[model samples]
Target: MAESPKRDTRDTTPDPKGRTQDRLIEHSYDGIQEYDNPMPRWWLTTFALTIIFSVLYVLNIGPIGAGKGWIADYEADMKAFAAAHPAPSGNDVSEGALLALVGDQKALAAGKSTFDAYCASCHRQDGGGLIGPSLVDNYWLHGGKITDIYKTVVDGVLAKGMPPWGKSLKPEQLTAVVAYVVSMHGSNPPNPKAPQGELVTP
Candidate 1:
């Protein structure tokens, strides 16, 4: 019979606290000892889960996490919202209806308020020309028709100093303003500024 080689045996088991009872000892020259302790099952499991979750989120390959993720979703939502709430149409006010507002005292008052708030800096409170041409005079740089006035108020003349008041004022407010301007015809102010532009029919 051949001689059997000697084998070293060591017990490896868990303690009551679930920690490994047998620690692997590392050799050191100065007698300072080091042992290898297995990480707790719960901690290892949690660390693995975290790594997996981070990979899934960062890769953007999964169904729910695809594309730009939350940012893409936010953009889609905002675009949908804008499509739902469109801007007011110019057709909301008719030329005939807008013309009717000229005699309306309440409408005129509203128009006057808007004009004072916005137009007074250029046109003056009395409709006499300041930086802008006289609103009271028959002469109009732009045409004098209700449609012409509407376009001017909405789009504005950048070459001149006037800004588009339609953006700041509501459609109804703009209609009222046009009415007030129409009502100003033929009533000359005391110190009327020099007349400018060709005369046109309202």
Candidate 2:
């Protein structure tokens, strides 16, 4: 009989440097085996850095974060803007000045234009009142004085539904609209809403 071939046995186990040999996982599928290897240190480091960066970014913005949040920043910017461009003073105008505009046909025309665009929806085109109280009647909800009317337009009645027009309307527009409203007093329209509020004598 021929002599049996000598069996050569060199260590197949992986060395401490992990370069000696590849270690196969115990499980196999369809005679295929996978090497048990760890992820590269560079790839893991990059993933960890991304997670840290995201956490820092969140903590620096919005209302929840450590930084002066977006709400505070927005409020500061608004304050600066208001300081730079101050609103026209309502107290400066006398009742006489506003009354004078009532006789000005040119002013009345502009006022009417603005009223038709904005006020007409609530107080009808004829000022007979629809959703709002009648302007043609002597009934005064806030007050009937021209100055009172000006304050109403500027400050608005929040309890009701009217919005403050001071910030939205230009100074001239506010003056003109108030003048138009004043001019409509006592000129009765065809069909008016039932009188509401305290009746004031002119």
Candidate 3:
């Protein structure tokens, strides 16, 4: 039978700190001292949970809206919906007179501004021709009535360089401009351009 090891009893007594030698709670091997402090209540709960939740939340919400290009899929679906249901019409005006209101004073002023800005470049300040025909004279390339003039404005003779101003000017404003034009007939300006078309009575 093997002999039992000898026990050291001299160092088994309590130390000067009043704690029992058995309850010292620490034993240093090299240079590190470790205490047995209990885990804090709030730190274990709030801090630990917050860190864990943040990692999970980012994984679920990031990188193209939760997964592989889900945002692109959503945009494509929206475009398809818009194509399926187009925008509705907005204006509530009669087909023909729509252009007549362009003759209104306020509308005429607006049309006049548009006219001066555009037509005046060729027709000159007083409606006499620089390159285009005179607008102030009784002779007209098209008819001279308000409705006829509105048609001429809207459906310009593209064969000639005159662009259809209908898309640019509202019908009411076009009418006002036509009225102003008719009002200028036989104006006999000091520098009237030579007449070209057959004279037509309004």
lDDT of each: 0.78, 0.83, 0.64
Q: What is the lDDT of residue 188 in candidate 1?
A: 82
Expressed as tens digits, the lDDT of each residue in 66-174 for candidate 2 is 5377557778999998887666575445799999999999989999999999889998999999999889988889888999999999888888899888768888898
Which parts of model 2 have CA positions greater than 4 angstroms off? 1-86, 90-92
TM-score of each: 0.55, 0.58, 0.47
Clashes of 3: 8
lDDT of candidate model 1 versus the reference? 0.78
Candidate 3, residues 1-202: lDDT per residue as tens digits? 5534533333346679865454233444455645445578987899888887677665554353354445555687889976875432243334355445544567567667767877777777677777778887777888766666667876677887888776566655555556556555666777878886878775
What is the RMSD of candidate 1? 13.1
With candidate 1 superimposed using the best TM-score fit, by how many Å does residue 8's alpha carbon deviate from the native? 85
Q: Which residue segments of model 3 deviate by more than 4 Å?
A: 1-104
lDDT (Cα, 0-100) at 19 in candidate 1: 75
In candidate 3, where is summed lDDT lowest over 10 consecutive residues?
86-95
